[model samples]
Target: MPRAFADITFTDSVKAAQSLYGSRDANRGFELAEDGRHEIGPREAQFISARDSFYQATVGDNGWPYVQHRGGPAGFLKVLDERTIGYADFRGNVQYLSVGNLMGDERVSLILMDYANRRRLKIWGRARIVHEADEPELVARLEDPSYRAPVERGIVITVEAWDWNCPKHITPRYTVPEVEVMLEQLHAEIADLKAQLANR
Candidate 1:
């Protein structure tokens, strides 16, 4: 756990739980995070760039938490800089719950998952919505020319800290593209086997 993440997550209540669970170490967490697991370096930037979808969480004025799934072509989330990331928020069901929640609180949490690779990344950041009128250049940078999803605004998330989760028991799930490649290899093997039998 990075200090940035651990700092916010390791509250007294959480510490009590850790004690109850028989884990009595906090230094290791901080030490490992300091060893370069917490910063948004090139590795993190590349990981975030390849993700097609991510789940964003926000707290509402009513104190309720909401998680919204944001998706686009691979690399929908744009890394503006080492510490900044933004994405074009497309129009959805029009509930506007996320926007409303962000209005009350700028704090945001994001989880980007690569199910096929059994990898997950957690990011803590403060986010603000930027309108086209307010930031046309940013909007253009994040927009996908091929994706026809009508973008309402852009959600700019400024990274405070990020952490990578352990890939324990994360069941591998294949996308259609992945399955197609597997099937192609199977067909090629069958053709090779048939040719060998004919030669015999």
Candidate 2:
């Protein structure tokens, strides 16, 4: 866990809960660590680049949190730099709850999961909505030509902090491509076994 994450997330109530649970001592290390770990490193960049979808949570002016799932082709979410990441906001349900929430409050939280590997990353950041009319070049950079989706706008996140979560309860899941590769390996093994039987 990064100190920056602890700094941003470990509020008084959270610390109180930790103390109540007798885990306060263990959690103290994150606060005392010298490295802030605010910037994304190589490992974080690779993981973020590989994610096709992420769950974004935005708080509205009414104090309610709205969580939305944003997805596209693999690597649709671009790692603009160590401290920044963005995605082309494709036209989806016209409710536009997330966009509206961001208008009131810029603070956003994201959860990116690697279900097959049972790994997840949590990120906190401030998001800015960029319109094509305002910054066409910036919005264009986030679009994936092969995805074939109508770009509505661009959501750029200036990352504040991030932390990797332990994969304890995450059930392993596979995408179609991943399942196909596993099936192919199993078929090859079966073919090799049949050939050995034939030779015998």
Candidate 3:
């Protein structure tokens, strides 16, 4: 049997929620529209698009939280509409724990943080899976360089609530020169290996 939160009375549920997550701020609830302060706006959408990766949280059959990193295009997340966002599910090795969890329960939370920019976006929603054969839009999104063949499905999230996370105190750095040198060395090694194989 599934662990049922539905069995708890409304008052008990409220108390439980507060105990678990701290006090209930009027700006933080299930419905984005209900919380005027937390609602996602145009600027929020742009910020999310700029993020490199997002963290996804799902509840497994045992009700334990399962979290993972989801990465792809610069703004792999697309705002399908005011209340919906679409994300492509990339190919991976056969452990489909997240997909299985989604099948049983759709509620999910996504967090995208740009440590360099000191910005973040938190999205709470319910997900619906769309098989590749059924969704042309998903197919197109998955066609980009970030993914390979054999996409199982795509997830469409109906946004319940979304908010901007407070900025953090971290600076960003890049190592362009080091990366270029490494690539050059790798190319030379590959050429040497090819010449040896040819002589053999």
TM-score to native of every candidate shown: 0.93, 0.97, 0.66
lDDT of candidate 2 at residue 193, scale 0 to 100:
100
lDDT of 2 by residue, 87-170 (tens): 999888799999999999999999999999999999999999999999999999999999888999999999999999999999
1-200: candidate 3 lDDT, tens digit per residue:
11111111126677578667866554233322333433357887787666557899999889998998987767777776677777778767769888989998898988887664566677878899897678876656634555454556778888776666667654553345546887999999999999999999
Model 1: which residue pairs collide?
A: none
Local distance difference test, each candidate: 0.88, 0.94, 0.70
* TM-score, structure 2 vs. true: 0.97
What's model 2's overall lDDT? Answer: 0.94
Best by lDDT: 2
How many angstroms is residue 151 displaced in model 2 relative to the true structure, after the best TM-score fit?
0.3
Give lDDT: candidate 1, residue 49.
Answer: 98
- Residue 126 CA error for candidate 1 (Å)? 0.4
Sort order, TM-score high to low? 2, 1, 3
